[model samples]
Target: MPMPQEYQLASQHYESFLTAAREALHLTTRNQTYTCVQATLLVFRHRLTAEQILMFADTLPAVLRAIFTSGWSIDDFKPEFGDEGDWKAEVKAVRVDHNFSNDETPARVAAVLRQHVDLPRFEKVLQQIGPDALRFWGFEASARI
Candidate 1:
């Protein structure tokens, strides 16, 4: 039997995420990329409103959408979105097993996400999120991509 279209699309989406993440981090394995992607998703989600987070997840591919919501807790409080350094520290603290580097890992992960996701739709979703959105993606507030 032929492969189902949904299965093929899901596979393609996952591969695209891994490929971009691996290339960004110069990593050898999708597992390593997955760690970074997962960590980034968690860290970023913590900073967004529940509604914004869901909107962002809706914009992602199937595998990424799953990763975004994996292990999420609805009753959890949204952390304060402080400066970039504070956010990076939180990411490191959240994924100590992955030993997330201060800035590079988040930047690489965000770059990978940008590479795979729909940019304009993402921008629209975060339009109300202000500079937090930009900084989370390792962008300067005024910087436009």
Candidate 2:
């Protein structure tokens, strides 16, 4: 079979995602957006089992899939989903000087991400993973964005 479009246009797709994320976060540079996005991905990743993470990653675009799973360790302790403040703090902790993630970061990133994925499959995976997963990604159980 021919190479997948995601693989063929990997750089283009990643740039598009970074552009959208930068705009959504109102960030001045792609580097700031990258730090925030990576940190946010890790915050969510810490709550999922390996199997669930794989299921979710399968729905992402090529570059995003790599970002979501990079440097993951299944042996790490999975933290419980806590308050939004703590989550935001965690997002800001990565490359602390560069990360500019705020309380709305996850929601903004989620909005941008929805535009790049198979929404139905993405939502299905979120639903299967349970309510906390849905909320972590700034999605509501019955709401479609």
Candidate 3:
């Protein structure tokens, strides 16, 4: 059967997000494996001059959480020893809490992440992350293609 029009449009949006993220991944980073997390956090950290962190903070975490819920092992990307917590852990905690493994922790962490991001900054990051990634992750970008 043909894919639904909504799914097709979402795939397009996801493609755009992948492109933006892929571009961001290439810019510069100390770690290659954590490139996506780095890019996402760079977006979250207000480090990107063009992007706002708050606007897309919620969506970013949602995308990450969905990925983990789908059975991806975040532990595959270990944080450097002495690093307090990174995006990978943060994303995992959200998924675990959502899945009832832990409840209160994700909320607190989400709040902290929110504080670090602002809507305007996040909007810019969203542009970086692309509407496609969001839609691909199941966040609504448009009602129709």
Give the top-scoring candidate (TM-score). Answer: 2
Q: Please list the residue runs of candidate 3 whose C-alpha ends up more than 4 Å from where it truly belongs after superposition.
A: 1-6, 27-68, 72-85, 88-145
Across 36-100, the per-residue lDDT of candidate 1 in tens digits comes to 77777787887777777788888788888988988777665466777767767776676578653
Worst 10 residues of 2 by lDDT: 136-145
Cα lDDT listed for each candidate: 0.75, 0.85, 0.36
Q: Which stretches of candidate 2 lie over 4 Å from their true place?
A: 142-145
Q: Tell me, what's the RMSD of every candidate? A: 3.3, 2.1, 15.2
Please give the range of 10 consecutive residues that has the lowest summed lDDT in model 1.
94-103
Ranking by TM-score: 2, 1, 3
Better of 1 and 3 by lDDT: 1
Q: Clashing residue pairs, candidate 1?
A: none
Q: In each prediction, how many residue pairs overlap at the backbone (N, C-alpha, C within less than 3 A)?
A: 0, 0, 11
TM value for model 3: 0.27
Model 3, poorest ten-residue lDDT window?
Answer: 97-106
Clashing pairs in 2: none
Which order, best to worst by lDDT?
Answer: 2, 1, 3
Give the per-residue lDDT of model 2 (tens digit) for 1-113.
Answer: 99988799989999999999999999999888998889888888888898898999999999999999999998743667776787787887778877788878888888898
